[model samples]
Target: MSKRKPQPPPKTFSVRPKRSLRHTLPFGLLLILILAAFSFTSYESYASLYDADYVGVEVCADCHTIMYDRWKDSPHANMTHQPSPETVVGDFNDSSWMLPPEGQLLPYDDELPAMRTFTEGADFYMALRRPGTADFTSFKIAYVIGYQYRQTYLTLEEGGSLAPPPPAMVYRTARVLPLLEPPREQHPHSRRFVGANDHPQFGVEPVLCPVPHHQLRHSGP
Candidate 1:
């Protein structure tokens, strides 16, 4: 007996069948979960409403008592208030000044004639004669705060309507401002009669309206 050939171990069929649903289900579910997560994050990132309705500053004041109190006392809070007698500095009396002589006609060929001499003792005066006629005049007064070399004055005319000055006699200047300056460019100085012909048309033009209380909206960085 050829050392009884060791009976070869019965061929044990151990081939592992390919895992179908078991392997694919988890991978498919994981891919789907990842896709959903990415979609949710993307939607949150880009979707936002800009320029939404605001609650207003008064509402904010309710929570910030101290800050609101300080803001209330600031000049911004009193910007549009009526000027009381105590706060007003100009002479309220009906002071008048003449722009040109009674019969003198301004030369239309040249620029409108400016006031040669204003009436003495008048609290208010006219800087330039009216457009066509010297007899028809407007009132002007020097500004208390002069910047840009241009005096800001209250014009008698408002958008082509003739409105008289307030009884308080609050007025501004009508001086042309400089547009360009030496080395550092400066605005033109205020002039009585600024026109298109003027170098920069500073005061004559309507571009330089001053905004005093614009900073009120800015709280901080």
Candidate 2:
């Protein structure tokens, strides 16, 4: 008897599922690695820009050897120094000069000139009359600037420091010297007379390079 041919084995079929992104890759782990790389690079870049402290040239030497080499022997590097026998070139031998009063040239009339004295001893000093007072205050020599032509002296400010440029910078050459809190020297070419400037701005314009490393020049001698 044919017995329905054993029901033809129930006609079964097998199907294979398609692979997806989550199955082929460690999707979460891959995403985490990408984010970590990005964060590490970003942190390094930003951290270097905002740190505003003088870490010194040696600190930068390792990373920027070329720049450090160019700057180390530059005039800016040797521009300023603590006063010593070797650094000071001025004739600070108790020398005295009868400078013009405040902001005028050598008095052709009845004005008494300001008196400046340079003394050298255990410690060098520059004695000059302070403004609004009749007494002369002796300020110790704190620093010396470069000597391309002449040496300039810098004394300590009110707090015994060279910061904020207290009547410090005594330029070596000038016709008139104002013994003011901030001296305004004049270099008027006219030998006959040089009047006091209403808006005096002949010398350094109150700008100071307190930072050891002044702005560097990348090109040109």
Candidate 3:
């Protein structure tokens, strides 16, 4: 009979919980990638700033062929060089002349002091007298500056090698030479005399490119 209808078997059901790892795993991976990229960039910047050296014009030419070509023709590139036949434009034909002391022309009425500039083979020399005395000191031409318009000669500064310039530079010297011209020699029309600037400090002087004074034009002969 309809005895208590057998209690319907209780329905069985299970509820599944949502996973947190799915969302968190992707977020953690993204954070890790960003950190790795930042660390790599920082290392590169540090290495470049502190570990670079002056590699000279040849190294520059490798990457900047066009720029190097233009600079090669400019006066700055030829401003200074080791003594050589082609680099030297001045006459070094074993000639010597007496220069008026300080600021005067030749043929002085009094026994004014005079300095001598002479050449031995290819080397140039300047003989200077100490002030208030007849002591003379001669300096040899160690380097030359200016070849196109005007030129100045430099002698190796005493104790120059003891203190080298910063590693970034290719060359450095504490000495400077004023423009000197022998009286008998026909100097370049464009050349002018400059005061001797002897720096007491040992270092490299700042160098700047000279502005071209005149341009050259070529024509058929």
Which candidate tops lDDT?
2
Where is model 2 poorest over a 10-residue stretch in terms of lDDT? 187-196
Segments in model 3 whose C-alpha atoms lie over 4 Å from true places: 1-53, 99-113, 119-123, 129-135, 161-221
Query: How displaced is residue 31 in candidate 3, in Å?
Result: 19
Candidate 1 per-residue lDDT, tens place, 47-145, comes to 233224434457767799998788766644432212233332433343333323542444541444434323335344444344465453445543222
- lDDT scores in order: 0.38, 0.49, 0.48
Candidate 2 Cα lDDT to native: 0.49
Ordering by lDDT? 2, 3, 1
lDDT of 2 by residue, 10-74 (tens): 77788888888778689778899999999887775544553644355567789989987777667
What's the residue-level lDDT of 198 in candidate 3? 32
TM-score of each: 0.28, 0.39, 0.42
Q: Which of 2 and 3 is ahead in TM-score?
A: 3
Cα RMSD (angstroms) for every candidate in the order listed: 15.2, 12.6, 12.5
lDDT of 3 by residue, 6-108 (tens): 7788899998877689878998999999999998877656446534643456667888999878877876566667667787665444433333344443344
